[model samples]
Target chain A: MTQQHKHIISMLVEDEPGVMTRISGLFARRGFNIDTITVGKTQTPKVSKIVITVKGDDRTVEQIEKQVNKLVDVFKTIEMKDDESVTRELCLVKVSLSNEKAKTDIMHYAQVYKAPIVDITPKSAIIQLVGKPQKNDAFLELMKPYGIKDISRTGTTAIQRGGNGEK
Target chain B: MKGSEAIVKTLIGSGVHTTFGFPGGAVIPLFDEFLRFEGKIKNILVRHEQGAAHAADGYARASGKPGICIATSGPGATNLVTGIMTAYMDSSPIIAFGGQVSMSLIGNDAFQEADMMGITLPITKHSFQIKKANDVVPTILKAFRISAEGRPGPVYIDLPKDCQVGEVTKEAPKKVDIPSFKPVYRGNINQIKKAADMILAAERPVVIAGGGTIIANAAKEVTVLMDTFMIPTATTIMGKGIIPEDHPLAIGQVGMHGRKAANYAVINADLVMAVGCRFSDRITGNTSSYAEKAKVIHIDIDAAEIGKNIEVDVPIVGDSKSVLSDLIVVMNEKLKKKTETEWSKRMKELNQLCRCNMDSKKEPIEPKKLLFELNRILKTDDIVVTGVGQHQMFATHFIDRMKPRTFITSGGAGTMGFGLPAAMGAKVAVPDTNVFDIDGDGSFLMNIQELATLKEENIKVIPVVFNNSYLGMVRQWLEIYYSKRYSQVKLGRHSDFVKIAEAFGLGGIRVEKPAKIQDALKESIRSKETMVLDVYVEPESNILPMLPPGGHLKEAFGGCMNAKGVFF
Candidate 1:
């Protein structure tokens, strides 16, 4: 039986044309299905930090990391696991509340989950939550009985919990 | 002018209305400008940059328009690679734009500083990196032109963050000039005459069409020639729908899983006209022995493709549509009827012989029956996409494509998830067209995440999975050659595909009974959302009429009836 585990990978690459095509081609051809990926600029100019979250076995992760590093633009690749890293995901949940009583009940539930009411209307309210995927999932599950209308989630973004600068 | 504004104008001028992308810091300026263009352009914000790339590919295949995708620097840019390669392999026109680091820090290993150009050189048709803001417009225009013209494929343009923020004169180049970018459009007249004479004089002549016909839009011209000459035609998997399958001259696909008559005819032909096809190993079993008795006349847009695999007696490098048109005209002028009624009768007899062998009652399920049922239930205009491997060959062999643009599958790259996403793209392109993805269980799971996208888009496609619980084609190879060690071939745990479909908020049905396939397919087609028909086929069942790899095409195995009348 193949064991499934999640890994967080961070890559530093040269900003150039068709870089994405090369990276994604490697994954697709190699048959590695990526779960989530987040990209943003770093503090240094011309450099960007890419956070990729993938669910696969240890061998698959190792192969992906090695192959990704072989790309011309890639400078480095670091894999972060749950125990070794800090991760967070943002979620916006729009819930339907027919009356004042339901809105009050929903707000009460949100407060217990540490979610903030970002926006409120007569018929519904949008609650903002930020935490690990599991935490967000649990909160969403708890609020499911309250008639959830829609949910938009930003896939996991992570950084090393304690900076050791191993690289 | 901001780099984003220039990019938008270039796309609009190039006739692009839709784009898929995910924005990041380096690309914020472009996305901001995108908002200002609002109604002029439509952007689909995908969950991931990779998804955006695939979505653009989907859009392009369906619309026959160049699909555009954008991504920020580093990871965002890297994510688009797979989709670009997918487009490249399938000859789908696409333009991908990525954010890059500023020119000053380009080689300094600055944040997100990765050499995208070098990485994508082998895969992309063309790639450009903008050093100056003024170059963006011309670069984009060139990329578009290169992507859409002749043997369409993916092109890329990288814009530095500083360039996006810089000012430039609003002058867009009216034309692009490239010295080495000429594509041949007309066939050589002498070669055309020689091929025509051979076809008219030969006792048996067969035409093998490939994806190049679709790329050249030469289906009509090909049909005209076939009908005029009363010649039989066969297609590669990518060549499906190039010739209407119901046409009397059509012989279905030719390959390992090709029809018995098509394979037999190819071996027996006196002259073979191969048009716009690369003659992949799958099509030509053994390069040296393929069409050993026949004189081959090969016409293709890419000169490199000719004589690369199989040597040709007559080679013409030009566009398929134009070459075929010239051939038709020449044939009409120079040719007289050379009737091969005897040869036709013999071929028909062999076809009948092959048909009888497939009717064995000992097998638990007949693949041909499944295909027949699917063909019966599917609409004439509905699109069918398949994953690569045995199932793909089976679908090509059995399914009759009656219309153009009704079959979408990966022929070059042979990517697995291609079926589901390509079908989605086809459905999105023609909302009214019923699209179905015929896949195997091993292939279906590759990009099953698209189920979420399908659900979100409310796009319905019927996914008929040939669930034999093994990598059917590879297992066939191992069984035939490697003594069937069965290393990682069997899917040990039965996948609850129906349950998985339900989890994705789509309808699902498990077909254990073969009789209910037609009804299940009909219902799935009529449904409002995506549906998965998990079919439980026999694990050890192999596609018959197998041509051993690296062996002569004529020396095909299986599809033979023993003395007891049992098909082996």
Candidate 2:
């Protein structure tokens, strides 16, 4: 079997209704595993940027990119290399305080991670962090022992790490 | 002008003179517009919306123009899904218009409303929902352009009730520009040169023409290449009729249930130039073993299809006619002489050795015999459309189609019930040509409801039904692959098709003996009205030279057999 890796594919697509489904449905129909997908309006008024992270072998990923590019609404598709691209995720975690000592420890750890407390209650505090997905994962691991109440995450979105922009 | 009127005008302006449709509540306003423009556009009302879609697909395949179909909302639109997918799989150019509830009631679970855009998005080349009246003309025009351009496929436009009734003010665009959807029409010069070099160096070369050849109208170019190079040629099922079956260089249809000579040539050839073919599994059985000895050159308009199924040594992405024309020019300049080589002699011997006995004096008629008789009487201009089944395979094996777009079948989707309506669509497109629907009992019954449409519309289509009263193909599979433990394969003698045909006020005949087959076909052809000839074939007969599903093409068995029960 060929070696498989998590691939990040970014695309510029027409801002048309059902364009997202057209893109995502292709992956589903082809049975490719999509790890995460993020979409937002681009600077161009009638276009949108979509970042999709999928797990597949090299050949399959190449095929997926070609198939995605074939969609009528898609303008272009490019692979965002890990070493040459900036990738980030936003994660919000609500941790149960339980005690003052625990709360101080959590706050200290939050400050070290540069994660700010966005909401606070007598029993819980919501820590909001925007960083690389691995960093957010590490923070979540540290909060596991504090009796975490809940967590929400925005899937990883990426851009090229250079002076030039993708057309 | 109203939005519906603008739509009618746009369709007429686009050179669409015929459309197939079934009306319902949501499309009442649009149907009224069709009424007002009755002379300008002839809308044939089909029994079912699915029939409408298939008929349009058939029209497109026959006429080489974009076919149009319409249906009401919800169930009506949903019924078109199968036919739309069929056209999509075959890459036929068709535009389907579906009605939707009023825009205000769209998301509120309005009566007779369905998410047509969502339902058909995956199956269509593109789909649009007319949000307002102003968008109607442009959307319809764009739909036609998109469906007919770039590899050609079905495009859908959903019309809401308000949009149909609303006023249109803006002028329709004279041309459509889609930035994201450009198709490459000329192959890379370097690649074309490489392909020419390969052809020159090849000791044995074979050409596999496909549906793309017909779409590109590259049959003449393919013929020139074959004659110039003295190469044997084979065609995929969709590619049938591109080359005359009786041409000395022709090796017949290639793939599962294909001719022995065709499969044998591909297996042994040193160079395989596949033009306008996607190498579907039906064509390239056991992909790992397919064309193992050949350095494959694949030329197609769709780049994605080139490498999707089979690996190619020389990949040329362009229109087949354009690419072949360039390749021919390069070859012509480089060639010193053209003569029949040892490879061509071997191919001729192989073709001669693969002939089967089509004349049997048995009581029950063999399906092959029926097709042989049909072939004798069929004019070069006559068209034969088939449903998917054993009869389709027999027709593929026996029928001799001498022109492009002469043999139409549901190749990719293999949709049964495609014959009747598709034949109707073809007859509509070419009234002067004789259109025959060669169907099986199992397949013909699937869309027998179209007999009424034939009677009312006066479309003269001869339905040559091979009525064995069994799903013969599946039964063959059961006998060979399974333990002959037939399960639900038999549709016992319950329905009388002659009575059924007469019920629709059409002519019908049942031919139980071999001698009556030719006369029945002749009678049907002579009649001005539609006639159904339900032929009783050998009950347990099977279509052979069969490659078991996923088996190597070279290993195809059971066409030529002696008393010893061994293949040649």
Question: TM-scores for chain A, candidates in order?
Answer: 0.91, 0.97
Candidate 2, DockQ score (0 to 1)? 0.67
Tens-digit lDDT track of model 2 for B187-299: 99999999999999999999999999999999888988777788899999888888877888898889998888888889989999999999988898899899999999999
DockQ score for model 1: 0.01
Model 2: residues with Cα > 4 Å off, grouped in runs: A98-105, B562-568
TM-score of each: 0.73, 0.96
Q: Per-prediction DockQ, in order?
A: 0.01, 0.67
Q: Could you give the C-alpha RMSD of every candidate to the true structure, in order shown?
A: 21.9, 2.0
Superposed Cα deviation of residue B447, candidate 1 (Å): 1.1
* lDDT value, residue B162 of candidate 1: 85
User: Under CAPRI classification, how is model 1 graded?
Assistant: incorrect
Q: Pick the candidate with the highest TM-score.
A: 2
In candidate 2, position B278 carries an lDDT of 91
lDDT of 1 by residue, B158-179 (tens): 8899888888776777887753
Native-to-model Cα distance after best TM-score fit, residue B504 in candidate 1, in Å: 2.7
After superposing the true interface residues, what Cα RMSD does each candidate give?
Answer: 11.5, 1.1
Q: Is the docking of candidate 2 incorrect, acceptable, medium or high quality?
A: medium
